[model samples]
Target: MIPELAPAKACAAKVLIADDEPNIVVSLEFMMKREGFEVLVARDGRAALEAIRREHPRLVLLDATMPGMSGFDVCEAVRADADVRSTCIVMLTAKGRETDMARGVGAGADAYVTKPFSTRDLVQQVKDMLAKDTAARALATGSAGAGELPKDMPA
Candidate 1:
């Protein structure tokens, strides 16, 4: 029998939830924390950008319709900044039109989620992104073998 491999450790990646809605903030916070992410909450778009610049979270769940700055603005700024361009951004929006989706992608958002989305799917997506990021970093640093396949890789 092959030796047992150690179970994957809970990810310590940082995630920022940028939304003005109190209920959404609380629910997303709870879900992310339960999945072992260190969470930061930003109640406005400007605040979200500030938090991202200061804290440098690996992932952000950004609301599209925040006061002052839109999620598109935040995504564009993050993508433009070399220091934080690698940060994965998911644009959360009530606007589900194809144009809205195009706008989000144009602004450099890595993913887009509708307002009424599945928490399980979002959580899993976050987890997968974090895992992929970690593996990429490891590979970049030459710590992990190049032959190793990420768990989510298709056969």
Candidate 2:
């Protein structure tokens, strides 16, 4: 008789949605949950930052304008903290101006996606970003295949 193999464990990736708008939060929460992500939410920037530090989510969908600290502030703080600096941040805001996008990137957000975004695109982007991050980490830890360099590295 053949021996049975145990199933591999799968850990769902955590995604934090930081937004003050109740409707937006509800939709995002539902979408993320449907996409198999473990969703965490914060209604304000302060709470968002607190959650980020405490929970260490794999990704953050940050709103630019919020009561208290502001998403830019939270992004900067996360980037400055070495322990959580690697956490991916995607600024999802109504502020669609080029200057605002620049500011988000300046503050260390991995991606800045304005509001009114396509949910399908957003989900794909998140998956791609997480995959890229995982690959980078694997390369940094020398677990990536022997002759391959991370995409960002010069040939």
Question: Number of backbone collisions per candidate, in order?
Answer: 0, 0
TM-score of each: 0.85, 0.88
Which of the numbered candidates is closest to the native, going by highest TM-score?
Answer: 2
lDDT of 2 by residue, 65-114 (tens): 99998999999999999989999999999999999999999999999998
Residue-by-residue lDDT tens digits, candidate 1, 1-155: 99999977544678999999999899999999887778999999899999999999989999999998998999999999998999999999999999999999999998999989988899999888777787988778777676775542222
List candidate 2 stretches off by more than 4 Å.
1-5, 144-155
Top-lDDT candidate index? 2
155: Cα error in model 2, Å: 31
Query: Poorest 10 consecutive residues of model 1 by lDDT?
Result: 146-155
RMSD of each: 5.3, 5.1
Would you list the clashing residue pairs of candidate 2? none
Please give the distance, in angstroms, between residue 104's alpha carbon in candidate 2 and its true position after superposition: 0.6
For model 2 the TM-score comes to: 0.88
